[model samples]
Target: MAGEHEHRDVSGGWLRAAVFGATDGLVTNSSLIAGVGGGGGAHHTIVLTGMAGLVAGAFSMATGEYISVTTQNEAIHAEVANEKAALAQDPVGEIAELADTYIARGVSPATAKAFATELAASPKDALHVHVQEELGVDAQKLPGAWTAAISSFLSFSLGALLPLLPYLLGLSSLPVALAVSAIALMAAGALAALLTGRSPIQSGLRQLLLGALAVGATYLIGHLLGAHV
Candidate 1:
């Protein structure tokens, strides 16, 4: 039972947000660095471009998370509110709805009806069944928008700094950017996998290789464009 609960926790919305936010930070900032490096941009320019990417990407992630999560929260709240109203006005019908939900989930009709009747004997149990079974929602809980915004903003800025640090220390243009981005991407991948309970080695290698390819491809493009210009 404990192990089952742990697995269920891993599938929650918060974990989803954390993975998505971290990945956004890593990929967007890394790609920005590669694009700037490829364009034959100078060290200062590269740093500045990275800073810009950090800010822009952070804001974008926050806004996107806010809109999406808030929309979900509202929908869930509305459903709970409707359920409460229905329970107040039509307790029998609401009990029947809960039983029907259980029946739909493979329980026999008689067993579902008995289970729902027992659940509805207690008001709290009735609400729990209505919310969990009928609505598929956690009625009392909502994701914190402020928390999401702050985490996203901070994660992007932190990730963006990876590419900019070498250039800040007076390292040569392309090589330093490449090296820093590579290390940062690998680290991010490993961290993501750790959080998601996956194989860190595999995730790290995949992300590192992808980042390398992106930077290498963009660098070549920039070099060619620079030569022509």
Candidate 2:
């Protein structure tokens, strides 16, 4: 039963944001570095570009995560409030609605009513079921926007630093920088794959390919622009 409940749990608000921030920061900053260097830009320019990307990307990820999570939580809370109000004002009707929902989902009429009736015995349980059914949002494990923001900020900064680190440490060659970036991206992807139950090798290769493509496209465009300028 304990193990079964584990699968039913919904959580990881911060973890999701952090992982996103880290992966995005790595890919985005590496691409910027590759693009600048590949275009025959100065080494200093690439370094500076990487730094700028890191700072801007970290802040952007944090702000975006905060707003997104906050808005979602607000909406869910609002719905929960509405459901609670409905239950308080018209519990019988609420029970009927819950019964209808269960019935629609394939429970027999009498069984559904009985189930709803049992649930409605406790107002809290009734509200919980109603919220889950009507809004499809979890009230017990609500997401925290601040947590998301902090995770994004910290993880994105750390990830973006990976590519920039070698450059900062005086490895100025474009090829070397890109090489490090590829390896880093692959490792990150592989690690992330573990969480998703995917093949690490396949996921790593996929991320490496995508990162390479992005760098190549940006490099081509930057090179063209540099030539004209």
Candidate 3:
């Protein structure tokens, strides 16, 4: 009997949705808070706006992930079913097809022949291997809707809470609010890096700089527009 090997996949629906949702929530909500505050909105009004943005953004992310993952899963299943049917209807032709594919990819004829022979013995496993290794598709991991929904909702909620820090703490100035927003974004990036196994320093610095630039630009614009008015 052949020993089974554990498969390790780096990409999936949950990872994609969680990462994107968190990043978007952090950046978008932070910018929204800063821009609104810079435009001279009251603290309570800013908090309400941020809360609305958070809820709307989370639902939007979840819905979008659901649609995308569902479409991809259907396509992968359809392809696998078609391949299975083809293999069942014509074993010899399927073997030739597999061999030709390997040969086109620079495998030697002898090696391709051996591979084709062994694969023909277990056509379903062979098909799965081809789909995974050759085509980079994972039919088994077709994004659970609940997982995507929860991750997106929670990520956005967590990220959106950052902008509310200054108001919640009763800090009474635009500068203080902006500072809190910057710190929140930086912390979010650090956490993201820790989860994703990247360099915390790099990620934190990137978010910090981006948030600062956004606040500065918006502050300037708001000041100019206020003066003109």
Candidate 4:
């Protein structure tokens, strides 16, 4: 547990979705704005495109996260219910299974059986123990679908605003917008790495590079389209 310090997580749960939504918003909106500007789009058209990307991206992220988390959570809850049923119908078999689990984890056979017996004396305790051992899920920490959806919506919109704010303020310089976006992405990446015990400087640079690539690629494509299409 030396490296297992508590910090914000953003890999495979609500936190992941929220962080993904925000970082994606920043990179995507910045690229869209850069692409439009590169294509010689008028000021109004550029701003409009950035606005469209922000709104569309936020809603899309929120909707996708909602469906994904809800479906997964429903499946897990169904499993928990089935576990409850099994515990109710076959108390002895369930206790044997629980004891087997503990024994497999290095507990002595007699001690494991005793532990299982004590747990089975209370229905709620047995249910909790069985569910965790069988499913590797913590009932108390199950993620909320609604929370993920709302968090994604808000975080994404806020991130997208970082790149779009300059244009809205009548700043026509694309370089300035890009600079702001790069710095924002670096900071976001560094902050995200804090929880995972990664080097913040490396993470920041990686994010900056990726965001730059996205902008560069879109800008070139937009320029080609404007020139030839």
Candidate 5:
């Protein structure tokens, strides 16, 4: 057992939603804060803007994730129903198809036929195999729309809260806000890379750079527009 290891369950849809929502929240709120501060907005205005962005972005991410996951699950369910009908109407042809599939995967023709025939004796087993081979998803493991939605909402709120903390605490310093957000962004990227088995340093730096770019661009635009206005 020393050398044996199990792989992480990366197939769950919640992780994706959480990571995307968090990163979007960090980037979006940070940029909004930078823009408002650069435009010479008062402390109260910046705080209000950050709070609004956090609430709106979290809800948006949750709704989008729920709808997307639900639609995909429905599509998979429809395909499964179709496969079930085919199994009932033409059992023999379905058995032959399963055998052919095994054969294509290098099982001998005789063994494949024998195995497929034996498997067909159980309707549930036959349906499961056919669905996996044809549709490429586990009928028993469909993603939960509520799970993804909740994860997105919570993660986005947490991420968006980081940058606004300084202002909310009455620091009223954009530099302090950006510094805190920068650290959080890099830490988040590193954590994601660690989970997915990638280079944490590379991912962290990439996140930091991209966030800085967005903040910088927004700040510059706000500054220019404020000057003119």
Candidate 6:
């Protein structure tokens, strides 16, 4: 047990959805706030814009995640069904193919044939093995569509709420909101880096820089538009 360590389940779709949703939410809301504030918008108007962005963005992310995950699952299921039909129609050929796969992977021909034949004894086992070997996917570990959708929805809401919190609390300070959102963006990046075994400092700076660009561009556009209009 000393040397054995458990690996994180990166296969599930929730991690990607949550990270992307949260990052997008923070950047989008912060940029929206900056743009409106730069455009000489009143506090109440900025708050309203932020709120609308949060709601609309969250729903959009959730809907997109759900549809994407569902479509992927459906495609995987179709492939699995095809594999099942193949196994049923040609058990011998399927087993031979599986054995050849193993032999190609440095397994002895005799052992591969024996192992494939043994696995072929059970329909479920044979199907699972064939599907995994052929498709490189675990039939049992398919990502949940609802799980991804809900994760996206909740994470996006939380991220988008960070910049809006200042206005919601009656602060009406654009600088304070920007500071908070910037910190949050860096923190989210650092956390993601830690999860993925990357350099936290680099990741955090990357997020900060990217968010700054978005905010700056929007703010400049808003300022120019406000001056003209």
Model 3 Cα lDDT, one tens digit per residue, 51-112: 88888888887787777767777888888888778778887887777788889999998899
Could you give candidate 4's per-residue lDDT for residues 1-229 as a string of tens digits? 6877665653366666666788999999999998898888888998899889999999998998899988987888899899999988998999999999999999999999999999999998888888889988776577788888988998899889999888899998899999899999998888768656689999889889998999999999989888975
lDDT (0-100) at residue 90 of candidate 2? 93
The true-versus-predicted C-alpha distance at residue 61 of model 3, in Å, is 1.5
Q: Report the CA-based lDDT of candidate 4 relative to the real structure.
A: 0.87
lDDT of 2 by residue, 158-229 (tens): 888988887798878877777888898898788777557679999889888888888889888888878887
Question: 2 or 3, which is superior by lDDT?
Answer: 2
For candidate 6, the clash count comes to 0
Arrange candidates by TM-score, highest first: which order? 6, 5, 2, 4, 1, 3
Tell me which of candidates 5 and 6 scores higher on lDDT. Answer: 6
Error (Å) of candidate 4 at residue 73 is 1.4
Ranking by lDDT: 6, 5, 4, 2, 1, 3
Judging by TM-score, tell me the better candidate of 3 and 5.
5
Task: Compute each candidate's TM-score over C-alphas.
Answer: 0.84, 0.92, 0.81, 0.90, 0.92, 0.93
Scanning candidate 3 in windows of ten residues, the lowest lDDT window is 6-15
Clash statistics: count for each candidate: 0, 0, 0, 0, 0, 0
Question: Where does candidate 6 have its weakest 10-residue lDDT segment?
Answer: 7-16
RMSD (CA, angstroms), candidate 4: 2.7
Model 4, position 17, has a per-residue lDDT of 67
> Candidate 5, 76: how far from true, in Å?
0.7
* Predicted structure 1: lDDT: 0.74
In terms of lDDT, model 6 sits at 0.94
lDDT of each: 0.74, 0.84, 0.74, 0.87, 0.92, 0.94
lDDT of 6 at 90: 97
